[model samples]
Target chain A: MGEAIVVTSGKGGVGKTTTSANVGTALALLGKKVCMVDTDIGLRNLDVVMGLENRIIYDLIDVAEGRCRLNQALVKDKRFDELYMLPAAQTKDKNDISPEQVRKIIEDLKPDFDYVIIDCPAGIEQGFRNAIAGADQAIVVTTPENAAVRDADRVIGLLEKTQIAPPKLVINRIRPSMLRNGDMLEVDDICQVLAIDLIGIVPDDEVVIKAANQGEPTVMNPNSRAAIAYRNVARRILGETVPLMHLDEKSGVFRRVRKFLGMG
Target chain B: MNGKSSITIKGVKEGLVFLLDDQCDFVTLLDELHAKLDKHEQQLAGPLVHVYVKLGARQLDEEDKERIRAIIRKQGNFLVQTIESDPVAEEAADYASYRLHTVAAMVRSGQTLEHDGHLLLLGDVNPGGTVRCTGDIYIMGALRGTAHAGCAGHEEAIIAASLMKPTQLRIADIISRPPDEWASAEPWMEYAYLADGAMQMDKLTHLHHSRNKVLQAKGV
Candidate 1:
């Protein structure tokens, strides 16, 4: 059975949605039959980021309410051979679906997919609990900002409250130049504060916004450094030990994409 | 006044107000309304003006309102603005809709909050979320989403947010822009309204209901 991993960040706007889309797309690109679920009802972006919003006939609510079968709500992503997404209902509130209902929905999804990465909404509310309810694993996305780190710690405590596996951390939008200039917080500082295992450190790239505006995930962008990092995170999720991307001040990102993809 | 007059049409500062007689048969009321507007069709042609239908205490069938709308359209280029019931019935409607929904959580993208009357939100309305209400909307947190107040075409409706940076806001029949104009106005709770075919944003504390007594109200 495919393991369900939830991408959550207690803090808002720290790249949880972006990480979910990229990491889930990377997993699917690695020949896994992957399904990405948007548990962030009301404020959903997985389908829009994946460029599959128009294909959604039924949604998570439809499946939970038995208005449609589970497969009927899964929108197939033609970007890859084995990728699909379960979109959240745009017109519904977060409280409309309970955690128990989500658990049952994921239970039905687990049989057909290899990796079910759920894109969770922000905050530690009903939507957050519902997103984490069905996951076998959790990936907490955060930035090096102190507020984000504090929220990530709180989220980690909440995950432990539910007795799931130790949550992994992905420090997104890392600005190495800023860190070197002593303007931004370092990855080690965030890791020390949050006290979680590091999964991925994504660099701040303008291409992410550009790709998102085009309705494409950054993982598919061969030229993006964040894409390479996301693919490495996907490998780590698959139990592959990959070194973190070294942020060099001189060579920067000129010669990394070829070297990153050549290894796979 | 015509002997069979059941529809009273009068000009006001806002536009035109029509009072539908409560005792008249629905069909006769509609017939008189159509005839009166058709007689003045030439005078009511190009410029679209607001039209309010006052139905005292009687609640007509919803389809009856639609038929009235069709008759108005067939006669002139008037926009049916609001259909207000009697004061007692309005009080009862308010009581029926007194369950003011409050979402004590952050509203995220693809989510929408809809209520019949006033909607009170204690969380941030993030981008991609939408909050709509037929009455006034009060957001205790930042409103970065799309908010449509007075969605049922009540011109007197207002939207107030603690930190107002909405993507778009609508009050009554007017849609507002200039979200960036008030980026510095977030710290102050802001409300929106429509004046002279354009949206006006002001501090919530200064929001005044522009209502008058029935006769003076009729002049407006």
Candidate 2:
């Protein structure tokens, strides 16, 4: 059976949808059959991010309510034949679906795909519960901001209470220049606070917004740093050992000099 | 009337002590107090005299104490300083407040862990997390959250952490200075406490030296 992975962050606007879209696209590019599920319900945006918004005929709610078959609700990605997306209903709220129904849907989808990527909603309410219901593993996305890190810690705590394995962390939108200036929280600091394995780190790139605005996942743009980060994350998910990308070479030199001077 | 007296008045440096008979009935005690006050009306007609009431083994509720205050008010020259009773049985909640609870889980953001007594945590307290205790709080890991020791108004309670980088610290009702003041990370473990009604921080090594009783082990 395929492994179900849920992408979530307790706070809103921390790149949960973007991470889901990019990671799913990257996995498909790696020759794996992938199904992306948008569990945000009324606030669904994964379809738009994956450039599949125009093709959705039926939605997740319709499939769960038995109004349509699961295959009927899936929208095919334009670039990859192996990648499919199950859109959320724009009219339905998160309370409309129960965790058991979500679990059932994921179970049915698991047999056909190698990876089922569930994009979770922002809050720790019903939507979060429904998204994690069928997830065997979880990826907690967070930014370097204090509020985002705090929320990610809360999400990790909640995930630990579930049957899913300990969640991996993805620190997104890091600004290397700000990090060098000592204005942003360091990657080590975020890791120390969350105390979870770091799966990937995506730097702050303007191309992410540009690609998303064009209704394409950032991973489709090979030149973007965020795209490479997502691809590395996908490789890690496939059990490949990839070294963490260097955020900045100057910061490394600065840190080494400080250590040499015994001022670190 | 029996020859033995039920109420005795003694003069001390600070005030006049009224030792009430604990074995007597409540109504009888009140009557005797009234009679004694009336008999000594002339002696009580002087400058304001502090009166201290001592109930050896008796417990008086709020209404009963008010009654005693009213009776003493009849002697206009007397000021009721205090009314005290011997120690009584403690409630279960109070007893639980003296316990030490050890927890081995991280207190995550938006999560609060409260204990009736002291709290000993084995994991980090992430930012936005809260830990409240009636006594003291001892964190074996980093404390990046809010910690409130002596939540029940114990001024002597303390909070100690291996890495003291908390967002906020409170001892009893006194809050610490802003997070900016506590931004630096000291090399050694540190603790926060209330000293002279103000919150203060120091190395954990000096805790026993400052508050000798804090390190004393409880007797079985």
Candidate 3:
């Protein structure tokens, strides 16, 4: 049976859709047939990130409402032969479809794909519920900020109610300089707050923004740090042991020496 | 007044209220009522069954009421509702009536565990999670959330945990110190209680050193 994984972050702009796009792409590159489902109805962005926005003819709502066949709504990605995406509807309200409807659509697509990645919407509302309805696993993305971590804590708490066994954590947009200067939360701090297993640590990279603007996920580029980190995340999901990305290695020996001394 | 006063029934717009006689033999009257209810079971069966089974109109304490509620639930067709006349008065009356609720699962963030009596959590309470109780709070695992030990104004209630690093801690009314820096180490078991109207926390070792004093205060 294919596994459905939901990439979610309770706080907005914390790289949920980004993670979903990259992870799904990486899985497809790993030779597994993957499908990316955007459950962020009413505020869709996954299609654009994957550079498949213009190719969308029918969306998830269309398939759920029986307006289109399940395979008819799946937009194939040009980059990978095995990769597909089901875009969310931008014209309807989030409440138009229920979690059961989303689950049914994913169930219909499960047998044909090896992995299904759902790009969840922000907040723990109806949209979030729909994204997680058919998910066998969850990846909670959060930043080092206190507010974002607090929301991540809440989202993890909610995910516990559904018994998503040991959901992994992804800390995104982390600045190593800030951590070295003792100005921001470290990975350990976030783990202490949210007692979850660490899966991915994406650094603050301008390449990701550039790729997003060009309607491409950074994971498509092998040279991008974020792309490498996401590939590591995809590997971890496949039960591989990958060490955490070294996020504190900045330029300059003076800063490195200072960091060594400040490691109290 | 009828001599047979073991049971009196009154009709309300919503449903019915049955007042049991306190002077009669309790078990006998209960069995009799249970037998009486069995005869009319089909007539009362419905999606909604609302009724009041007051142990004593105004004198029954919280435990008694709870026991009566349990009995009503055990009956054929009745949804027991304990009508509280005054929240304050009933709370005051229920001050000494407490229960020890044991939950064997980790309390996650965004989730809340609220109880009218003592709460014993078998797992860690993560950050951003809140565990509120009217009486004492005990956590078998780590404590990293907001915990209100005496949520119902019971200052004597205490909170104890194996690892007590809370984001926020409250004893009765006072909010304790802010969450401490995240330490990636196994902290010793800690306990939180009130002393001189202020919250005080101590490691289990120190509390064990002053066992007489700590025990005296703990029983308060």
Candidate 4:
């Protein structure tokens, strides 16, 4: 059976849905049969992020409530032959579905796909529980802010209590300029607080927002810094070792110059 | 003689000692005690005399103690100061407060690991994570979260961590200054404690000077 991964962050507005969409897209692009499940229910955004919102005729609640079969509810991503999207119900709240139902849906999808990426809702409530119920692995997304890091730490603690493998952290929305100016919390600091393995670091790039506005994942644009980070995270999920991208803009030029001189 | 009393009364310096026979039935003992007090009513009527009742091997519940107290109250000028049993009840298993509990797991944010006694954590206390103990708390890793040592009103409790950057530190009832005031990059394990009702911080090595009991060991 394929593994199911949940992208969750305890606090809201921490890019969990964005990470889920991009990572799922990257996995599909890497020749893995990937299925993205939106467990956010009433507050679903994964469909919109994947640009599959208009194509969704049946959703998670429809399949859960036996109104439609699992395959019928899965919306195919026309861009990638291997990618699929299981949109959440817009009318039903998180409490409408139970963890057992979510687990069953994930289990059903796992055998048909190489990877199941679940987009979790914010907060440690019923929605979060439903999202993680069937996940074999977890990705905790957080920003560099103290509040986001704090919430990420809380979510990590909760994730540890679950059967999922120790959740890897994805530090999203990192601003290298703010970091250099000492105005933002460093990646090291966030890692120190959460005490988890770092899976990826996506910098604060305007491209992510622009792509989202167009209902497209940033990973579609290979030149975007955030896109590279998400792709690296997907490769890491496939057990590939990729060096972290140089986030310091000035240091990249300095290091390139030093390498070119070769001490001459 | 078969008519012999099962209760004996003696006068000590502080009070009157009533030695109740353990072998007799409780009802018989109470009857004999009442009779004895009634017999000495005239002699016991002087000043307000303290009465101490000793139950040799008898376990008296609260109701039984109240019954005995009521009987003594019936006797004029007698105040029941103490009602004790020879076999002391085992103290509740509060040994947890004295024992050191070792946990080898990260205390992540929004999670609280509480111990009745001292806590020795092998992993980090991440921000928003809390580790509370009735006694001292020792962490082998970073403590970026909140550590409340002596949570159960133990003012002498101390919280020590390898990396002492915590969101908040609480010892007993005293909370530390805001996280800004405690921001330090000193590359030494540090500890926080209450001194004179105020929070104090110092290097871990100097802990022995303030709390010698922490290092002291008693053996047979």
Candidate 5:
């Protein structure tokens, strides 16, 4: 059976859709047939991120409502033969979809794909519930800001109640330079607060924004640090043992040195 | 009152209150009533047996009512008592004491929930929403939000739900996270409680088993 994963972050603008697009693409690149579903409904962005916005004819709502067949609504990505995108309906709101309907759709799609990645909408509402309805696992994306971490923490708590097992954490938009200067929250700090397995630690990168604007997820670019991190996260999802990159090695050394030198 | 086996338990109220107990098999009760009517056939020469077993005109909660109804169903339509008031009063009292308390329509940012009692959330507690309750936290729906139970440090506090996932969890400081490799998609009713100074989860497969056993053993 295919793995149905929801990329959710209770807080808005925390790179959930971005992570979904990239990770879905990455997983597809790993030879896993992947389908990315945009569950945001009215405020859909996953299609745009995957550069498949203009190609969308039938959306998720259309398929769920039986306006179109599931296969017909699935928009194939130009980048990978194994990758498909199911755009959300911009006209219909979150209420247009039900959890049962979403679960049915996922069940229908599971046998055909290796991974069903859902780009969950911001906020814990009808949209969030729909995205998670049939998800086998969840990836909670969050930034390092207090509000983002706090929101991530809350989402984690919510996921626990689902009895869906613990959702993994993906800390995106991290600034290693800020961490070096003691201005950013470290990965360990986030892990301590969230108390979940760290799957992805994406550094703040302009490449990601540029790629998103171009309708291409940064994971396609092998040079981008954030892209590499996302790919690593995808590998982890596939049960690979990839080691975490040292984003703040220089600053970590300085801190150790400072602690070693107890005297002036 | 005029019937042979009619036990009339009275109050200021109108009609008879039927007492249902688990002491004898329901067949035995009905058979005894039938036999009593047969013995007094001359005194009460009615074709049908009218054996009214009245317990009392007592109010009960929904749970108690369900229990009573289950027993009544097992007895199967022989014993009939006219209740002066609706049996619903007991349901009202029971529900009033433990009606699920759903939080505000939205659990917004920077808000913390510290409830001494059960927390029934109708909506989601978006990320950054913190809840610390002394009793169980029941999110009627999804709980991808953070919740900490046993805040007063009660280890007995259970965190249960239809869908469960939390970022950070502490059941009386016995901190444990979900298995890193667990990504199963099943709608399960799971409870987390402190076991051996650690958090443990168990499937709530026996909803009525525990209470039923206790009641049966207590001879209630």
Candidate 6:
């Protein structure tokens, strides 16, 4: 059985799609069998971000409604043999999906994969509920901005109400220079306001944009700073006691990765 | 029946009197008193009808007092004169010792609490939720929300939360606004109290800080 993780953010455009794609790729590179599901039914973008949009012959709606099997709808990653994706249906609305159906799909995929990361839709509606229904853990993604942090705080409250304890935090798109100048909220400020254990802090990098546009997750490009951060986060999820990465510098990917892997 | 009237009156010369005993059923006693009053119905009832209810000293707990009040109010036509068997001063002292402290099972977001004594909450205090306590405030769940403690100027009063990440915490006249940075640290119990003439938070331990609690309840 695998860990079903839901990448959720209450506010839109806070890098949930980017995080899911990169983290899923990172975990698969570590030799873990991974499946990424896009729960944003009508507004699907995970497939596009992963560059698997043209290859989707069937969507989650078809598999859920029994028109096609789960395996037939899964789009295998071209770069990684262990990575696969179940893209959301752009034509279908969130109401067409149910938590029970999502749970059944994740349960079916559990024994075959080591990780199933669900990309949650924005807002605290049916779409959000559907994404978390099949998951064991939640990764709340937020930015350094107040609006994103506030929305993340609200989502944390809702998860607590649903009895999902200790949902980890991922602060995405952190600009260190702005933070140093007191222009952006620092990591400590976000944690203090959100009050959750942090899992990852992906710095704002041009490599992330370049990699996403190339249909390759930034985590695959070992030279990328955001990729190294995602790799450290994956190790943390695997129960490693890696010290936090320094987001200030753009150097030391190998040294930090070794330190994270306990080989340093 | 002790008195010949529907309202069985007991006279106490020194203090207020109430007669509630285990030997006599309250219903039967009421019925017999009413019968006696019916027998003496020939006398025209005057103004100021005083019906004294006798409650024993031993039966002065919450349940018995509420029951007696309920029964008296239900019994029509009786202008009941209720008296406590226990001394009022002693009762007031006891009541003051243990004030009303109730924490709802689920304290949702936007919920506010203004309590006098020790406030103990069992659920998580989410962000935007607030709890203001005059005495010590103890939350069994995570305190990731906002809280105000020792609001009545009890500086010695401490606020303890299971997991403290309050946006703003006020103790006495001091407030601690959360620093603008992420705190990558392990979860630990946090206790906030007055220190160095301001509010301070420290890990929960058997540590002591000698600070004067300025509680001005009387004209000094």
Q: How does each model score on lDDT? A: 0.82, 0.91, 0.82, 0.88, 0.74, 0.77
Pairing residues by index, what is the TM-score of model 5? Answer: 0.56
Docking quality (DockQ) for each candidate: 0.01, 0.52, 0.47, 0.59, 0.10, 0.07
In candidate 4, what are the lDDT values of residues A118-162, reduced to their tens digit? 999999999999999999999999999888887887888788888
Better of 2 and 6 by lDDT: 2
- Model 6 steric clash pairs: A187-B182, A188-B181, A188-B182, A188-B183, A189-B181, A189-B182, B18-B54, B19-B54
Regions of model 6 farther than 4 Å from truth: A163-165, A249-264, B1-127, B132-220
Number of clashes found in candidate 4: 0
Report the TM-score of the second chain of model 6 against its true counterpart: 0.47
**Candidate that would win on DockQ:** 4
In order of appearance, the predictions have TM-scores of 0.53, 0.76, 0.74, 0.77, 0.56, 0.61
User: What's the number of clashes in each of the models?
Assistant: 6, 0, 0, 0, 34, 8
Per-residue alpha-carbon lDDT of candidate 3 for residues A1-264, written as tens digits (9 for 90 to 100): 798899998999999988998899998888889999999888999998888989999998898888989989999998899999999999997899999999998888889999999899998999999989998899999999989998988888789889566689999998878888999998898887687899999887777888888888788877667788999999999989999988755334334433544632
Whole-model lDDT, model 1: 0.82
Candidate 1: TM-score? 0.53
- The digit string of per-residue lDDT tens for model 3 on B1-220 reads 2446576767787778887776667566767677657666776677666787655534556775676666667655677775343233334736457889999876776788888898899988887788999998999988888899878788878888887778888987888765342232445777887888877776666665544543354454
C-alpha RMSD of candidate 2: 13.6
**CAPRI docking class of candidate 6:** incorrect
- The stretch of ten residues in a row with the least summed lDDT in candidate 5 chain A is A255-264
The CA root-mean-square deviation of candidate 6, after full C-alpha superposition on the true structure, stands at 13.3
Best by lDDT: 2
Candidate 4: TM-score?
0.77
Off by over 4 Å in 4: A250-264, B1-97, B179-185, B212-220
lDDT (Cα, tens digit) per residue for candidate 4, span B147-183: 9987767788888888888889999888885555566
- Interface RMSD of each candidate, angstroms, one decimal: 9.5, 0.9, 1.8, 1.1, 5.8, 3.8
**Which ranges of candidate 5 are over 4 A from the true structure?**
A249-264, B1-220
Where does candidate 6 chain B have its weakest 10-residue lDDT segment? B87-96
